[model samples]
Target: MDLEPPLSYGHGICRPRGFAKDPLVKTVPAIEALHPEMTEWRRDFHRHPELSFEETRTAGLVAQRLRDFGLDPVEGIGKTGVAAVIDSGKPGPSLALRADMDALPMDDRGGKDWHSHTAGVAHTCGHDGHTAALLGVARHLAAHPPASGRVVLIFQPAEENGLGARAMIDDGLLDRFPFDEVYAFHNMPLLAPGQAGVRTGPTLNGYIVWEIAVEGVGGHGAAFFKATDPLQAAARLAAEISSIVGRYLDPAESGLITVCSLQAGHSHNVIPAHATLSGTMRALKPEVMELLYQRLETACRGVAELTGCTIACKRLAEVPPCVNAPEGADRAAAACAEVLGEGAVIRDHPPFPFTDDFALFLEAAPGAYLFLGQESAMCHNPAYDFDDALLPVAASIFTTLVRQRLGYAGTHARSVAPPST
Candidate 1:
């Protein structure tokens, strides 16, 4: 159940050997037609944001919607994730599209009309928008099945904590609903609202969090020289580790280290015997992460020697980088180009510093993870909210990606089947 992902998922995605040129934008207009309903769904989710592994009502709503669209939705994958299949009753290839469904543990300060109804739970990451957009795709796909193939729509949970993707994989997500390729996307801040970025290489970095525990003899502060002060060691380590991101890595390469939390003495008069320092290290390449761990252990050893403290470093939640396969990347770029124009897709963008659980999905199956540009407040910020105007855009992107991946060409391109919302 805890198997690590393959070292690299470099195979071509499921398509016509190569990516289709300029994915047909036939469904773009139809997706635009469903904008109002999609916005309603997104706002409803925004008002009732749920935290990781607890998306009961959100999952229920998605399930009902999928059912209404005439697809059999299976609940309870990866705790609160949902997966539904559109078999098309024919055979070609299976493609999977995923969107996360969870909110961060924070108060809503965006002041939107449909801000979080629950205090300390907010959808600052734009997952509400992602869910709604996927729902739009679900309705569209249900009404107009591809000529031949299966399309699996996955509504995942716990993305903020970086475990949901793995949980779903372990729960036989791949075995139960196997696909030739997989895809997912996240909204980005500060970019044009109608554009997206997709590349064929590492799109996001890998990260590992380390918690360092140091223990030394506690003694009276009046005679501090007599005792090994763990607090002093912790202070020194925290400052030095902060420089690791910029100092340790090459000037041209990308890496980050954040000494976020430190805990030590409780009383002013006494030097505490125990202290802990915790933070994270991120890098775009696997080798960089390896080198980072080595440097971290070296830092711990050097600090311990200087402070005469016993130090123990524990690595937590080491997530791998999310790289997009060539086929999937091309398909995604073409889809974006078809929907929003060629200028809307960035094929050679740099990797993001943050980590995504979707990395695990790409590792399991050759796929791509894209970023949709929408001018808005940065994610994870208290005031951040997904731009409602981007709903139809993302939905169009999803629709085009699916059609291109399945090679839905010719007459099927122009028709809009009976509406399903």
Candidate 2:
């Protein structure tokens, strides 16, 4: 939902938070200069949290900051997304770096100084830190322009609901700001702060949100024999759906099916005519996900026949698994190794069950999605906050990627060309 800021809420730049350096990670020397400001911007974003496609304030701030950094930012893309380009005068393969810009629809009980001011909204997934880090990248790249190729900065909205990346792509994002390679990262609480996780293939699972409906006769609770209880049918279907992962999936493969919600009659004395069941199914492989969906439908049919009820299943949303291209993954690992050392670059982590719409972008271009470690509460947890320490580390890695791909170097900086409108 769209929640506007108060009139007193100004878009002026936030004061630097003076974030301390992390001893374990060797961040880029150049990014260290912007650490405090990046933390401040991140906290500012956390304080004024916005949800899903309703990131007007966040987008406005991003566009304004990009302009301040001397880059022209296009607004209203994907409804509330923002993008800016830093063109290097010389001709070379262009690179795009992206960050999501939406907050979760939950309470901010973290009790931090910069806790979310809006009710029922919070930056629980570290998107605030991602946005702030990308902004820092923009500021750094604007000043230090790439050695040859251009860099496109994307501030995408609605990633939480798995729509932002597709939204931008459907709005001709790729055509408008074309790039040969793309890259994005999400903060992970599973590893130590500043450590990087990069897997060669299937970094994230594909998922489908599904709903099931069961129809039967309704009657008073007292009339037990006469009533055809849809709730019982729905309950059986839920149990059957839960078993699909274990019963149908291959032993070597991993998948998940969860029944998150079930709704039936409102009154305790009555049996409802209809019942609804909804949940999600996730798998690392597209074929596996398809198999799971097939099994789910089969289970529904069998449950319907056994209970003498009409059952129908509907798919709400689907996202393909995020597989990192070999070239992109290698570059990401090298970049991480350059910034955080080789030992900190993890390559053995299994595919995450979580889904990101960034999968759509990976499908469009050769790129990778890496996870930067943070020593904090798990993502989506109310207590989670993006480690300010990661600001410099993440920005450093993005900068190093440009240097590695586009031939940019800190020693010989080029004069930045004027940003185009």
Q: Highest TM-score: give the candidate number.
A: 2
Q: Indicate the TM-score of model 2.
A: 0.89
For residues 1-421, write the lDDT of model 1, one tens digit per residue: 0112223222222222111122422236777789889999999999999999999999999999999998899999998999998876777888899999999999999998998999999999999999999999999888887767888899999988888888899899999999888899898763455557788988888888889999999999999989999999999888777767667788877677778899999998999999999988877788888888888888899999888899999997878888899988998888777765676677766666678888888887888998876666788888998887677778777787777767553465655333332
Residue-by-residue lDDT tens digits, candidate 2, 1-421: 1112112211212212222243435566778779889999999999999999999999999999999999999999999999999998889988999999999989988889999999999999999999999999999889888779799899999998888888898999999999889999998766556567888989888889999989999999999579788999999888888888778888999788889999999999999999999998887889999999999899889988887889999998888899999999999999998776677787767666688888888898899999887777778888888888888888988988988899874565433222223
TM-score of 1: 0.88
What residue runs in model 1 are displaced by over 4 Å at the alpha carbon? 1-27, 243-248, 409-412, 415-421
Q: List lDDT for all candidates, in order.
A: 0.82, 0.85
- Lowest summed lDDT across 10 adjacent residues in model 1 is found at 12-21
Compared with the true structure, the alpha-carbon lDDT of candidate 2 equals 0.85
